[model samples]
Target: MLRSGISIISVACLLLFAPIAPSLAAIAPPLNLAHSPITQLSVPMALFSFSGSRPNYLGIEDGKLSPCPGTPNCVSSQSDDAEHGIAPLKYNNSPEQAIAELKQIIGNMKGTEIISDRADYLYVEFTSSLMGFVDDVEFYINPEQNVVEVRSASRLGESDMGVNRKRVEAIRAELNKLEAQEAQA
Candidate 1:
């Protein structure tokens, strides 16, 4: 009797799951590559362009431009102004105090420049962590409230960039929370 009951349960289980097997097997056919192939492909390797990312160290010799070795697509005859300037955001506080606070938040950093400063926002550019990409950071601060908010957009290669973006966003959220707490204090 127990053997028959086990067999009955097995058959019932198989019957219940049988319908799902066909649905699982009904996957769409593989992409019809032969019917329609994406022949015209354009790869935008802007990172390879010298203007895309400027090196920290530039060497010029004998009326010729020489970038450091291992730099990608370093042009020996290009002007320094190949890229667009990144204007820093402004702050309401005096420039000196704002600069101090900015440096304090981001410590021991190199290759950063203050592009613009106003009463509310401060714009800054810094060499990105990526090998050949620069990121622009915009800081909006309320001096009276002693609050600081920072925004930055990063340029990155195709691999795992989404995860990195999320990490940066998490950092932004934490900073914003800190700013709120400071404002409350």
Candidate 2:
């Protein structure tokens, strides 16, 4: 009885797929290389996009950038845990001047979009060059702390390969360089 039941299922499957086989096979014609120097096609630089939706918990909540989410793909100066803790940026200038310098530095980065820019708060999106994955980075100049609180989090994925941390460091380096240039000038 079991053998007959199995056979019945097998036959049913074959009958269901048999008529569609020819149509599937005819979906594409055989490749033709008869013409030499075939036309070239252009595709966007970042072919695959994985940018997740923007989070609502961005910007300052209580005189600070949002705490890093419970994931390895995030880093925040406001976070206390070692896994997510990063020092806030210190500047010896007015908050407006600090924000202006930050805007210039971040605007020049590739695949970046400045979503929101204010005197003391900025929300920027940084997209990866290859897979087009986006990371949301925020900076809030807390006059009370006299430092810029930062939060960088990947929109999608559990592991960003330390990208968020490295980006913060790079921005810190850039800020330092810019400060030095201004000091000299």
Highest TM-score scorer: 2
Using lDDT as the measure, which candidate wins?
2
lDDT of 2 by residue, 1-185 (tens): 23334365765666688678788779967767567454354445453578878888787766867777788999999899999999998888899988998998898888889999888899999998656899999999989878999999999989999999999899899999999998999
The list of candidate 2 runs beyond 4 A from truth reads: 1-45
Candidate 1: list runs displaced more than 4 Å. 1-99, 104-107, 143-146, 155-185
Write out the backbone clash pairs for model 2: none
Please, what is the whole-model Cα lDDT of each candidate in the order they appear? Answer: 0.44, 0.85
Per residue, candidate 1 scores C-alpha lDDT tens digits across 1-185 of 23334365765666687668678667746455555556455534321222255333332234222321232212111223332112223344464555565655444454456666655555555553323355545555544454444444443332434432343344445445545666788
Worst 10 residues of 2 by lDDT: 1-10
How many pairs of residues collide in each model? 8, 0
Residue 66, candidate 2: how far off, in angstroms?
1.9
